[model samples]
Target: MPDATFKIFRGDRDGGELYEYKVPIAPGMVVLDALHYIQAHDAPDLAVRWNCKAGKCGSCSAEVNGRPRLTCKTRLDALPLDQPITVQPMKSFPVLKDLVTDVSWNYRVNKKIPPFTPRPNVEWKMDQREVDRVQEFRKCIECFLCQNVCHVLRDHEKQEQFGGPRFFVRIAGLEMHPLDGLSRTELLKEELGIGLCNITKCCTEVCPEDIHITDNAIIPLKERVVDDFYDPVRWFLRKLSGKKH
Candidate 1:
Protein backbone atom coordinates (compact mmCIF):
# COMPACT_ATOMS: atom_id res chain seq x y z
CA MET A 1 0.00 0.00 0.00
CA PRO A 2 2.87 2.33 0.93
CA ASP A 3 6.65 2.32 0.67
CA ALA A 4 8.49 0.55 3.51
CA THR A 5 12.09 1.17 4.48
CA PHE A 6 14.27 -1.89 5.05
CA LYS A 7 17.72 -2.00 6.58
CA ILE A 8 19.34 -5.20 5.41
CA PHE A 9 22.82 -6.31 6.42
CA ARG A 10 25.26 -6.47 3.52
CA GLY A 11 28.67 -8.08 4.06
CA ASP A 12 30.66 -11.26 4.74
CA ARG A 13 31.91 -13.18 7.78
CA ASP A 14 34.58 -10.54 8.35
CA GLY A 15 32.10 -7.67 8.82
CA GLY A 16 29.09 -5.87 7.38
CA GLU A 17 26.82 -2.84 7.58
CA LEU A 18 23.08 -2.34 7.23
CA TYR A 19 22.14 -0.94 3.85
CA GLU A 20 18.81 0.80 3.62
CA TYR A 21 16.41 0.19 0.75
CA LYS A 22 12.94 1.47 -0.01
CA VAL A 23 10.38 -1.09 -1.18
CA PRO A 24 6.74 -0.55 -2.14
CA ILE A 25 4.47 -2.63 0.08
CA ALA A 26 1.79 -4.97 -1.22
CA PRO A 27 -1.07 -6.84 0.42
CA GLY A 28 -0.07 -10.24 1.82
CA MET A 29 3.59 -9.48 1.12
CA VAL A 30 6.02 -11.27 3.40
CA VAL A 31 9.52 -10.10 4.30
CA LEU A 32 11.06 -12.50 1.78
CA ASP A 33 9.12 -10.84 -1.01
CA ALA A 34 10.53 -7.49 -0.02
CA LEU A 35 14.00 -8.96 -0.04
CA HIS A 36 13.38 -10.37 -3.52
CA TYR A 37 12.28 -6.96 -4.64
CA ILE A 38 15.49 -5.45 -3.32
CA GLN A 39 17.49 -8.06 -5.24
CA ALA A 40 15.62 -7.30 -8.43
CA HIS A 41 15.56 -3.51 -8.30
CA ASP A 42 18.48 -2.46 -6.15
CA ALA A 43 21.23 -4.78 -4.94
CA PRO A 44 21.45 -7.62 -7.44
CA ASP A 45 24.45 -9.12 -5.60
CA LEU A 46 22.49 -9.63 -2.37
CA ALA A 47 22.94 -13.18 -1.15
CA VAL A 48 19.92 -14.86 0.54
CA ARG A 49 19.27 -18.56 1.12
CA TRP A 50 15.67 -19.53 0.46
CA ASN A 51 13.98 -22.63 -0.96
CA CYS A 52 10.23 -22.97 -0.32
CA LYS A 53 8.70 -19.55 0.05
CA ALA A 54 5.72 -21.23 1.69
CA GLY A 55 7.65 -21.45 5.01
CA LYS A 56 7.91 -25.26 5.09
CA CYS A 57 11.52 -25.44 3.82
CA GLY A 58 12.92 -23.32 6.72
CA SER A 59 15.65 -21.98 4.42
CA CYS A 60 14.43 -18.38 4.51
CA SER A 61 15.32 -17.77 8.16
CA ALA A 62 16.60 -14.38 9.27
CA GLU A 63 16.35 -12.00 12.18
CA VAL A 64 13.55 -9.57 11.41
CA ASN A 65 13.46 -6.50 13.66
CA GLY A 66 15.90 -8.30 16.01
CA ARG A 67 13.76 -11.45 16.24
CA PRO A 68 14.68 -14.85 14.80
CA ARG A 69 11.99 -15.77 12.24
CA LEU A 70 11.43 -17.26 8.83
CA THR A 71 11.38 -14.37 6.42
CA CYS A 72 8.86 -16.20 4.28
CA LYS A 73 6.41 -16.39 7.16
CA THR A 74 6.93 -12.90 8.55
CA ARG A 75 4.29 -10.63 7.12
CA LEU A 76 5.38 -7.04 6.62
CA ASP A 77 2.08 -5.87 8.09
CA ALA A 78 2.89 -7.67 11.32
CA LEU A 79 6.06 -5.62 11.75
CA PRO A 80 6.26 -1.95 12.74
CA LEU A 81 6.76 -0.44 9.33
CA ASP A 82 6.94 3.09 10.78
CA GLN A 83 10.58 2.30 11.50
CA PRO A 84 13.00 0.60 9.14
CA ILE A 85 12.64 -3.17 9.32
CA THR A 86 16.05 -4.79 9.86
CA VAL A 87 16.85 -8.15 8.32
CA GLN A 88 20.13 -9.78 9.25
CA PRO A 89 21.84 -13.16 9.38
CA MET A 90 21.45 -15.40 12.42
CA LYS A 91 23.88 -14.11 15.05
CA SER A 92 24.86 -17.47 16.53
CA PHE A 93 26.63 -18.68 13.39
CA PRO A 94 29.35 -17.29 11.17
CA VAL A 95 27.91 -14.99 8.51
CA LEU A 96 28.65 -16.21 5.00
CA LYS A 97 27.38 -13.15 3.21
CA ASP A 98 24.36 -10.86 3.51
CA LEU A 99 21.56 -12.88 5.14
CA VAL A 100 23.28 -16.29 4.88
CA THR A 101 25.06 -17.85 7.89
CA ASP A 102 27.37 -20.84 8.22
CA VAL A 103 25.22 -23.41 10.05
CA SER A 104 27.60 -26.35 9.37
CA TRP A 105 28.39 -26.57 13.09
CA ASN A 106 24.82 -27.77 13.68
CA TYR A 107 25.40 -30.61 11.22
CA ARG A 108 28.56 -31.65 13.05
CA VAL A 109 26.66 -31.72 16.32
CA ASN A 110 23.91 -33.75 14.66
CA LYS A 111 26.43 -36.34 13.50
CA LYS A 112 27.28 -37.11 17.13
CA ILE A 113 23.76 -38.25 17.95
CA PRO A 114 23.17 -41.96 17.40
CA PRO A 115 20.39 -42.98 15.06
CA PHE A 116 17.17 -44.67 16.10
CA THR A 117 18.03 -48.29 16.93
CA PRO A 118 15.01 -50.51 17.49
CA ARG A 119 15.16 -52.79 20.53
CA PRO A 120 16.11 -56.41 19.87
CA ASN A 121 13.21 -58.55 18.63
CA VAL A 122 10.78 -55.75 19.37
CA GLU A 123 7.31 -55.68 17.81
CA TRP A 124 6.94 -53.01 15.15
CA LYS A 125 3.48 -52.12 16.47
CA MET A 126 3.41 -49.23 18.95
CA ASP A 127 0.66 -47.49 20.91
CA GLN A 128 -0.91 -44.60 19.07
CA ARG A 129 -0.15 -42.25 21.98
CA GLU A 130 3.52 -43.20 21.91
CA VAL A 131 3.64 -42.60 18.19
CA ASP A 132 2.04 -39.19 18.66
CA ARG A 133 4.56 -38.22 21.35
CA VAL A 134 7.56 -38.70 19.08
CA GLN A 135 5.75 -37.31 16.08
CA GLU A 136 5.78 -33.80 17.56
CA PHE A 137 9.57 -33.77 17.27
CA ARG A 138 9.48 -34.81 13.62
CA LYS A 139 8.13 -31.36 12.71
CA CYS A 140 11.49 -29.70 13.15
CA ILE A 141 12.53 -28.11 9.87
CA GLU A 142 16.08 -27.26 10.98
CA CYS A 143 15.41 -23.54 10.66
CA PHE A 144 18.05 -22.93 13.37
CA LEU A 145 15.94 -20.04 14.63
CA CYS A 146 15.76 -21.79 17.99
CA GLN A 147 19.52 -22.27 17.92
CA ASN A 148 20.02 -18.63 17.08
CA VAL A 149 17.82 -17.47 19.96
CA CYS A 150 19.44 -19.74 22.53
CA HIS A 151 21.65 -17.78 24.93
CA VAL A 152 24.28 -20.51 25.32
CA LEU A 153 25.11 -20.32 21.62
CA ARG A 154 24.31 -16.67 20.99
CA ASP A 155 25.78 -15.03 24.10
CA HIS A 156 28.34 -17.45 25.56
CA GLU A 157 29.34 -18.97 22.24
CA LYS A 158 29.31 -22.49 23.72
CA GLN A 159 29.24 -24.16 20.34
CA GLU A 160 31.97 -26.57 21.50
CA GLN A 161 30.37 -27.43 24.85
CA PHE A 162 26.60 -27.23 24.33
CA GLY A 163 24.32 -28.61 21.67
CA GLY A 164 21.63 -26.01 21.16
CA PRO A 165 17.88 -26.62 21.61
CA ARG A 166 17.55 -28.01 18.07
CA PHE A 167 19.66 -31.12 18.78
CA PHE A 168 18.03 -31.62 22.14
CA VAL A 169 14.74 -31.93 20.25
CA ARG A 170 16.39 -34.45 17.94
CA ILE A 171 17.70 -36.44 20.91
CA ALA A 172 14.27 -36.33 22.53
CA GLY A 173 12.66 -37.83 19.45
CA LEU A 174 15.14 -40.69 19.42
CA GLU A 175 15.03 -41.26 23.16
CA MET A 176 11.26 -41.22 23.41
CA HIS A 177 10.62 -43.60 20.53
CA PRO A 178 8.85 -46.51 22.29
CA LEU A 179 10.66 -49.31 20.44
CA ASP A 180 13.97 -47.49 20.11
CA GLY A 181 16.75 -48.71 22.36
CA LEU A 182 19.31 -46.03 23.18
CA SER A 183 20.35 -43.96 26.16
CA ARG A 184 21.58 -40.51 25.12
CA THR A 185 21.66 -39.32 28.74
CA GLU A 186 25.43 -39.65 28.73
CA LEU A 187 25.67 -37.64 25.52
CA LEU A 188 23.34 -35.01 26.97
CA LYS A 189 25.47 -34.74 30.10
CA GLU A 190 29.04 -34.56 28.82
CA GLU A 191 28.92 -33.65 25.13
CA LEU A 192 25.63 -31.87 24.48
CA GLY A 193 25.76 -29.94 27.76
CA ILE A 194 22.04 -30.02 28.59
CA GLY A 195 22.87 -28.56 32.01
CA LEU A 196 23.72 -25.27 30.35
CA CYS A 197 20.06 -24.74 29.51
CA ASN A 198 18.15 -22.99 32.29
CA ILE A 199 14.79 -23.51 30.60
CA THR A 200 14.17 -19.88 29.78
CA LYS A 201 12.01 -21.05 26.86
CA CYS A 202 13.61 -18.53 24.54
CA CYS A 203 14.17 -21.24 21.99
CA THR A 204 10.56 -22.28 22.20
CA GLU A 205 9.47 -18.72 21.63
CA VAL A 206 11.30 -18.54 18.31
CA CYS A 207 10.41 -21.97 16.96
CA PRO A 208 8.54 -21.78 13.63
CA GLU A 209 7.07 -25.26 14.02
CA ASP A 210 5.45 -24.37 17.36
CA ILE A 211 7.21 -27.41 18.80
CA HIS A 212 7.20 -27.40 22.59
CA ILE A 213 10.95 -27.48 22.78
CA THR A 214 11.28 -26.54 26.46
CA ASP A 215 8.33 -28.28 28.03
CA ASN A 216 7.85 -31.49 26.07
CA ALA A 217 11.33 -32.21 24.68
CA ILE A 218 13.94 -30.48 26.84
CA ILE A 219 12.40 -30.90 30.29
CA PRO A 220 11.79 -34.62 29.83
CA LEU A 221 15.30 -35.10 28.47
CA LYS A 222 16.73 -33.20 31.45
CA GLU A 223 14.83 -35.46 33.85
CA ARG A 224 16.20 -38.50 32.04
CA VAL A 225 19.72 -37.15 32.38
CA VAL A 226 19.21 -36.64 36.11
CA ASP A 227 17.77 -40.10 36.54
CA ASP A 228 20.67 -41.72 34.70
CA PHE A 229 23.47 -39.66 36.26
CA TYR A 230 22.20 -38.14 39.49
CA ASP A 231 19.65 -40.48 41.08
CA PRO A 232 21.07 -41.58 44.43
CA VAL A 233 19.72 -45.14 44.36
CA ARG A 234 20.75 -45.58 40.75
CA TRP A 235 24.21 -44.19 41.54
CA PHE A 236 24.57 -46.69 44.42
CA LEU A 237 23.40 -49.53 42.22
CA ARG A 238 25.88 -48.55 39.54
CA LYS A 239 28.66 -48.34 42.11
CA LEU A 240 27.78 -51.75 43.61
CA SER A 241 27.65 -53.30 40.15
CA GLY A 242 31.00 -51.69 39.20
CA LYS A 243 29.39 -49.78 36.41
CA LYS A 244 29.60 -46.16 35.26
CA HIS A 245 26.76 -44.31 33.59
Candidate 2:
Protein backbone atom coordinates (compact mmCIF):
# COMPACT_ATOMS: atom_id res chain seq x y z
CA MET A 1 0.00 0.00 0.00
CA PRO A 2 2.96 2.31 0.73
CA ASP A 3 6.29 2.93 -1.00
CA ALA A 4 9.32 1.44 0.77
CA THR A 5 12.69 3.13 0.54
CA PHE A 6 15.71 1.08 -0.52
CA LYS A 7 19.33 2.09 -0.05
CA ILE A 8 20.98 -0.07 -2.70
CA PHE A 9 24.71 -0.03 -3.29
CA ARG A 10 25.85 1.26 -6.71
CA GLY A 11 29.42 1.07 -8.00
CA ASP A 12 32.40 -1.14 -8.82
CA ARG A 13 35.57 -2.64 -7.32
CA ASP A 14 37.22 0.77 -6.69
CA GLY A 15 34.37 1.96 -4.38
CA GLY A 16 30.66 2.66 -4.20
CA GLU A 17 27.85 4.36 -2.29
CA LEU A 18 24.24 3.60 -1.50
CA TYR A 19 21.62 5.15 -3.75
CA GLU A 20 18.13 5.42 -2.37
CA TYR A 21 15.03 4.51 -4.37
CA LYS A 22 11.35 4.21 -3.64
CA VAL A 23 9.20 1.33 -4.88
CA PRO A 24 5.57 0.45 -4.40
CA ILE A 25 5.19 -2.54 -2.08
CA ALA A 26 2.82 -5.31 -3.06
CA PRO A 27 1.38 -8.18 -1.03
CA GLY A 28 3.99 -10.91 -0.38
CA MET A 29 6.57 -8.95 -2.33
CA VAL A 30 10.14 -10.06 -1.94
CA VAL A 31 13.25 -7.84 -2.01
CA LEU A 32 14.10 -9.12 -5.48
CA ASP A 33 10.71 -7.94 -6.65
CA ALA A 34 11.51 -4.48 -5.32
CA LEU A 35 14.88 -4.57 -7.07
CA HIS A 36 13.20 -5.58 -10.34
CA TYR A 37 10.88 -2.63 -9.92
CA ILE A 38 13.83 -0.30 -9.52
CA GLN A 39 15.51 -1.75 -12.60
CA ALA A 40 12.36 -1.36 -14.69
CA HIS A 41 11.23 2.05 -13.41
CA ASP A 42 14.19 3.93 -11.94
CA ALA A 43 17.63 2.67 -12.85
CA PRO A 44 17.57 0.61 -16.06
CA ASP A 45 21.36 0.16 -15.88
CA LEU A 46 21.43 -1.32 -12.39
CA ALA A 47 23.22 -4.68 -12.21
CA VAL A 48 21.96 -7.66 -10.18
CA ARG A 49 22.70 -11.37 -10.40
CA TRP A 50 19.87 -13.86 -10.06
CA ASN A 51 18.54 -17.09 -11.47
CA CYS A 52 15.64 -19.45 -10.66
CA LYS A 53 14.35 -16.71 -8.25
CA ALA A 54 13.07 -19.60 -6.11
CA GLY A 55 15.91 -19.53 -3.53
CA LYS A 56 17.16 -22.86 -4.90
CA CYS A 57 19.92 -21.41 -7.11
CA GLY A 58 21.44 -19.26 -4.36
CA SER A 59 22.40 -16.56 -6.89
CA CYS A 60 20.55 -13.60 -5.43
CA SER A 61 22.57 -13.30 -2.23
CA ALA A 62 23.13 -9.84 -0.71
CA GLU A 63 23.53 -8.10 2.58
CA VAL A 64 20.12 -6.91 3.70
CA ASN A 65 20.09 -4.68 6.79
CA GLY A 66 23.75 -5.69 7.15
CA ARG A 67 22.90 -9.42 7.22
CA PRO A 68 23.73 -11.99 4.58
CA ARG A 69 20.50 -13.18 2.94
CA LEU A 70 19.05 -14.46 -0.27
CA THR A 71 17.20 -11.40 -1.55
CA CYS A 72 14.72 -13.55 -3.43
CA LYS A 73 13.54 -15.10 -0.17
CA THR A 74 13.65 -11.97 2.03
CA ARG A 75 10.15 -10.56 2.23
CA LEU A 76 9.60 -6.80 2.18
CA ASP A 77 7.12 -7.01 5.04
CA ALA A 78 9.75 -8.61 7.26
CA LEU A 79 11.94 -5.50 7.21
CA PRO A 80 11.42 -2.16 8.93
CA LEU A 81 9.79 -0.07 6.23
CA ASP A 82 9.86 3.21 8.10
CA GLN A 83 13.53 3.62 7.18
CA PRO A 84 15.54 2.89 4.07
CA ILE A 85 16.23 -0.85 3.69
CA THR A 86 19.96 -1.26 3.20
CA VAL A 87 21.07 -3.75 0.52
CA GLN A 88 24.65 -4.20 -0.52
CA PRO A 89 26.84 -6.74 -2.26
CA MET A 90 28.52 -9.32 -0.04
CA LYS A 91 31.61 -7.78 1.58
CA SER A 92 33.66 -10.97 1.59
CA PHE A 93 34.15 -10.72 -2.17
CA PRO A 94 34.91 -7.90 -4.58
CA VAL A 95 32.01 -6.00 -6.12
CA LEU A 96 31.57 -6.20 -9.86
CA LYS A 97 28.64 -3.83 -10.02
CA ASP A 98 25.59 -2.74 -8.07
CA LEU A 99 24.38 -5.70 -5.95
CA VAL A 100 26.67 -8.07 -7.88
CA THR A 101 29.96 -9.47 -6.52
CA ASP A 102 32.97 -11.32 -7.87
CA VAL A 103 32.40 -14.77 -6.45
CA SER A 104 35.08 -16.37 -8.61
CA TRP A 105 37.29 -16.80 -5.56
CA ASN A 106 34.96 -19.50 -4.33
CA TYR A 107 35.39 -21.39 -7.58
CA ARG A 108 39.16 -21.18 -7.30
CA VAL A 109 39.08 -22.58 -3.78
CA ASN A 110 36.77 -25.42 -4.81
CA LYS A 111 39.14 -26.61 -7.52
CA LYS A 112 41.80 -27.46 -4.93
CA ILE A 113 39.66 -30.02 -3.11
CA PRO A 114 40.04 -33.58 -4.34
CA PRO A 115 37.01 -34.93 -6.11
CA PHE A 116 35.19 -37.96 -4.67
CA THR A 117 36.97 -41.14 -5.63
CA PRO A 118 34.98 -44.24 -4.83
CA ARG A 119 36.85 -47.22 -3.52
CA PRO A 120 37.90 -49.69 -6.20
CA ASN A 121 35.85 -52.88 -6.60
CA VAL A 122 33.44 -51.68 -3.92
CA GLU A 123 29.77 -52.50 -4.24
CA TRP A 124 27.81 -49.63 -5.79
CA LYS A 125 25.01 -50.13 -3.30
CA MET A 126 24.92 -49.14 0.35
CA ASP A 127 22.28 -48.84 3.04
CA GLN A 128 20.42 -45.53 3.09
CA ARG A 129 21.46 -45.07 6.70
CA GLU A 130 25.12 -45.03 5.66
CA VAL A 131 24.64 -42.01 3.41
CA ASP A 132 22.07 -40.23 5.57
CA ARG A 133 24.69 -38.16 7.40
CA VAL A 134 26.47 -37.09 4.23
CA GLN A 135 23.21 -36.26 2.52
CA GLU A 136 22.73 -33.31 4.85
CA PHE A 137 25.73 -31.64 3.22
CA ARG A 138 24.36 -32.13 -0.30
CA LYS A 139 21.62 -29.58 0.48
CA CYS A 140 24.13 -26.74 0.03
CA ILE A 141 23.45 -24.61 -3.02
CA GLU A 142 26.85 -22.91 -2.88
CA CYS A 143 25.34 -19.56 -1.83
CA PHE A 144 28.56 -18.64 -0.05
CA LEU A 145 26.68 -16.63 2.58
CA CYS A 146 28.50 -18.91 4.96
CA GLN A 147 31.76 -17.76 3.41
CA ASN A 148 30.77 -14.10 3.62
CA VAL A 149 30.01 -14.41 7.33
CA CYS A 150 33.09 -16.43 8.27
CA HIS A 151 35.50 -14.25 10.27
CA VAL A 152 38.41 -16.06 8.69
CA LEU A 153 37.34 -14.67 5.33
CA ARG A 154 35.37 -11.54 6.21
CA ASP A 155 37.29 -9.75 8.95
CA HIS A 156 40.66 -11.50 8.84
CA GLU A 157 40.88 -11.76 5.01
CA LYS A 158 42.32 -15.28 5.08
CA GLN A 159 41.31 -16.27 1.55
CA GLU A 160 44.78 -17.52 0.68
CA GLN A 161 44.94 -19.71 3.76
CA PHE A 162 41.35 -20.79 4.38
CA GLY A 163 38.80 -22.68 2.25
CA GLY A 164 35.81 -21.10 4.06
CA PRO A 165 32.71 -23.03 5.22
CA ARG A 166 31.31 -23.79 1.79
CA PHE A 167 34.30 -25.92 0.84
CA PHE A 168 34.46 -27.53 4.25
CA VAL A 169 30.87 -28.70 3.83
CA ARG A 170 31.80 -30.14 0.47
CA ILE A 171 34.85 -31.82 1.97
CA ALA A 172 32.67 -33.21 4.72
CA GLY A 173 30.34 -34.80 2.21
CA LEU A 174 33.25 -36.36 0.39
CA GLU A 175 35.05 -37.46 3.54
CA MET A 176 32.00 -39.04 5.12
CA HIS A 177 30.68 -40.76 2.00
CA PRO A 178 30.68 -44.52 2.50
CA LEU A 179 32.60 -45.36 -0.66
CA ASP A 180 34.87 -42.33 -0.88
CA GLY A 181 38.49 -43.42 -0.85
CA LEU A 182 40.38 -40.16 -0.44
CA SER A 183 41.45 -38.49 2.78
CA ARG A 184 41.26 -34.70 2.96
CA THR A 185 42.53 -34.20 6.47
CA GLU A 186 45.97 -33.07 5.29
CA LEU A 187 44.44 -30.74 2.76
CA LEU A 188 42.20 -29.30 5.42
CA LYS A 189 45.12 -28.70 7.73
CA GLU A 190 47.92 -27.62 5.40
CA GLU A 191 46.08 -25.86 2.59
CA LEU A 192 42.55 -25.04 3.68
CA GLY A 193 43.78 -23.97 7.11
CA ILE A 194 40.91 -25.58 9.00
CA GLY A 195 42.58 -24.66 12.28
CA LEU A 196 41.97 -20.99 11.56
CA CYS A 197 38.26 -21.41 12.17
CA ASN A 198 37.44 -20.82 15.84
CA ILE A 199 33.94 -22.36 15.51
CA THR A 200 32.09 -19.04 15.75
CA LYS A 201 29.00 -20.62 14.07
CA CYS A 202 28.28 -17.32 12.33
CA CYS A 203 28.19 -19.23 9.06
CA THR A 204 25.47 -21.56 10.32
CA GLU A 205 23.29 -18.65 11.39
CA VAL A 206 23.05 -17.19 7.87
CA CYS A 207 22.68 -20.44 5.96
CA PRO A 208 19.37 -20.58 4.06
CA GLU A 209 19.56 -24.36 3.56
CA ASP A 210 19.88 -24.99 7.33
CA ILE A 211 23.04 -26.97 6.75
CA HIS A 212 24.95 -27.35 10.02
CA ILE A 213 28.19 -25.88 8.69
CA THR A 214 29.88 -25.42 12.04
CA ASP A 215 28.65 -28.46 13.93
CA ASN A 216 28.53 -31.11 11.21
CA ALA A 217 31.04 -30.01 8.58
CA ILE A 218 33.63 -27.76 10.20
CA ILE A 219 33.85 -29.35 13.66
CA PRO A 220 34.22 -32.88 12.27
CA LEU A 221 36.89 -31.75 9.85
CA LYS A 222 38.64 -29.94 12.69
CA GLU A 223 38.57 -33.11 14.78
CA ARG A 224 40.16 -35.13 11.98
CA VAL A 225 42.90 -32.53 11.69
CA VAL A 226 43.50 -32.70 15.43
CA ASP A 227 43.57 -36.47 15.52
CA ASP A 228 46.11 -36.57 12.74
CA PHE A 229 48.39 -33.80 13.96
CA TYR A 230 47.69 -32.79 17.55
CA ASP A 231 46.89 -35.95 19.55
CA PRO A 232 49.73 -36.31 22.07
CA VAL A 233 49.65 -40.10 22.04
CA ARG A 234 49.64 -40.25 18.27
CA TRP A 235 52.49 -37.71 18.08
CA PHE A 236 54.52 -39.79 20.51
CA LEU A 237 53.84 -42.97 18.54
CA ARG A 238 54.78 -41.30 15.27
CA LYS A 239 57.99 -39.99 16.80
CA LEU A 240 58.94 -43.37 18.24
CA SER A 241 58.02 -45.50 15.23
CA GLY A 242 58.75 -42.94 12.47
CA LYS A 243 55.54 -44.19 10.85
CA LYS A 244 52.03 -42.82 10.74
CA HIS A 245 49.37 -44.83 12.54
- Assess each prediction's global lDDT (C-alpha) against the native: 0.95, 0.94
Per-residue lDDT tens digits for candidate 1, residues 127-146, read 99999999999999999999
Candidate of highest lDDT: 1
- TM-score, prediction 2: 0.96
lDDT for predicted candidate 1 compared with the true structure: 0.95
Clashing pairs in 1: none
Each prediction's TM-score versus the true structure: 0.97, 0.96
- Candidate 1, backbone clash total: 0
- Please give the distance, in angstroms, between residue 55's alpha carbon in candidate 2 and its true position after superposition: 0.6
lDDT of 2 by residue, 72-97 (tens): 99999999999999999999999999
